[model samples]
Target: MNENSHTMSERPHLRVVHGNPTDEEVAALVAVITTLNTRDTPAPPPPRSAWSDRRTLHRPPLPHGPNAWHTSTFPH
Candidate 1:
């Protein structure tokens, strides 16, 4: 394997396709672009907690007949 091949493959993540720009200018441009991209994209919704699960709220009503207290301790 060529020793310089690894260095060659480590190209800049962002490259200007057109127009010459100074190092600081390129950095500023990248920062602005990244900020705008992040701003435009909405963040993913937060994960739902078990306490807020809708399915858990739709449980069968607890029985009121004999052994109601015992049954309530376990799933129907």
Candidate 2:
């Protein structure tokens, strides 16, 4: 009457279908199967933005017809 009652008396239909687990319900089902087979501690990657090392401004193309809106080769 050990080894889980000899595997529930050699699987009497798995012992009347699921009916025998009380060692504190097999220690709370082995603590929920060891917390669902552990493995969850990865979250630390987000902090690098000096405006993404700024560098991208080649503006120069807006002058074509009718005093191009009182143009002034922008660069005040």
| Candidate with the greatest lDDT versus the true structure | 1
Candidate 2 per-residue C-alpha lDDT over 1-76 given as tens digits, one digit per residue, 9 for 90 to 100? 5655545337643232477776787777678877776747566899978667555354567787988777856553
Task: Tell me the lDDT of candidate 2.
Answer: 0.64
What would the per-residue lDDT of candidate 1 be over residues 1-76, giving only the tens digit for each residue?
6554445568667867999999999889899999998899788999999998888878788878999898888876
Could you report the Cα RMSD, in angstroms, for every candidate shown? 5.5, 11.2
lDDT of 1: 0.84
Give each model's clash number. Answer: 0, 0
**Global lDDT of each candidate:** 0.84, 0.64
Alpha-carbon deviation at 63 in model 2, angstroms: 10
Instruction: Please identify model 1 stretches exceeding 4 Å from their true place.
Output: 1-9, 43-60, 64-66, 69-76
